[model samples]
Target: MNQILPLELPNGISLEIKREDLLHPFISGNKFRKLKYNLLQAKSEGLETVLTFGGAYSNHISAVAYAGKEQGFKTIGVIRGDELGDKITENPTLKFAQDCGMQFEFVSREAYRLKTEPDFIAKLKDKFGSFYLVPEGGTNEYAIKGCEEILTDKDANFDFVCCAVGTGGTISGIINSALPHQKVLGFPALKGDFLKDEIRKFATNQNWELVTDYHFGGYGKVNEELVQFINQFYQQTQIPLDPIYTGKMVFGVIDLIQKNWFLDNAKILMIHTGGLQGIQGMNTILKSKNKTLIEVQ
Candidate 1:
């Protein structure tokens, strides 16, 4: 539970990465905060199983699998995609998952969205026998409680706090902790203008703004510039960022800084929401010439 680990920026700004991603190899990153409330509700209900949804590279699904394994609960991930992919090879998140002995169930994208269906839950209950369902990102009341624990006892010198807003849990928690004088900014990873409405529907905030410009090509989509930024960021700072969620947020943060959005000496702590495992597919998609480009004879 070590919080507020500090690092300094090149421009004489003192910053911290808020080592939440180091919390657990499996339950790593902000996903833990989002899942905390749902986990408690499951225990209170005497449920021995937990089910959740996510895409092929969902940070939420990975977190749930790890949490269930660590807590000794039967974990099932309702993955959205065609039922394919090698589960044997460990991608980072799944490696810890396999270690914890979590189970997975693959469903088509259509079925995964019916997460709230009575028949769907009933089917899961029939198969798994009395389990709790954690919504996609595990963002709920307990997530807020877990996130509320994040900003405790930090340096009082910070001008503002910034983070990637996916499910709105982390930003909401920061908003709760910020004083009336402080400002909370969320750079969204979701595509289009629909995310603002989704933010309005789920989050407990009226002041937070969603910066839609930096999400790259939408959730889980990236391009050359983002890849270069990650490479440069790692070479310079030794910090690796996952492209889909946290990577874009980091890029957005840096851009905002360069534009003088924050005060010259403002202290901004960027949360490194861990998706290190998803790098597999991202690398697969990226075709930098430096990576071994042998000409076919």
Candidate 2:
């Protein structure tokens, strides 16, 4: 559903949000889109186990765990940071995945970097037997195919479509399906220009660009200012945003609007890619540092 924000803006600009977050209670947003075809292919191939990778509070990990269980596939999460293995009880995301029957193989950061290496995958297959692999962040050809369905003919009137970028799959899908007149803006949660090439590998059009100024440090890093903004946004809109992704994108879009970066009378659509499940884990970190918490019911 698309809901227009009632905020007053300069130049008669209008802002509306696509609530992809409400797609599911667990496998919500882009995760749902990315996994839809992947799970189907896995089942068609007669694979009973699905293996994927992520960090401690990765939305991909949480979603894959629940979706796999719900679909009758055994899940294995190759998680970064070996120390997190024993800390599952203290981590909301990991605990939830465990509760959903997702087994974990925790590795060090250095070893985790080799996640895409052929030798590493060969070792995994040797140990765990045959299983369908879903890359980290769930970005693959099949995932992009799923993400391409996010936009519809009803979205053609919008001048700009904005979304948070992680693995570049979702934005690639958006870029592929966007109308030629509409520009797709991706606010990456991570800091870097490398994502451009990643997006280019899949995106067939040149209607998109990444706004890199609003990462708030980098992926998974948030401060008091961002926390305050998230709390304020939620209090006003009654829409919860996860600090890692959508919150940062929304903050950047509004900040750009305040700076009059958009043309007069421009209509903007923001995609809520859904990472609300990470809030509890983030609040745990924030409380440890005596920082303000995001108010989400």
Tens digit per residue, CA lDDT, model 1, 157-257: 56666778887777777777665555667778877776666555545656567778898877776777887787777666666677777778888987876
| Runs of candidate 1 exceeding 4 Å displacement | 1-14, 85-99, 201-205, 287-297
lDDT of 1 at 250: 80
Q: Which window of 10 residues has the lowest lDDT sum in candidate 2?
A: 1-10
| TM-score, every prediction | 0.85, 0.99
By lDDT, the best candidate is: 2
lDDT of each: 0.70, 0.96
Residue ranges of candidate 2 with Cα displaced over 4 Å: none
Error of 1 at 118 (Å): 2.9
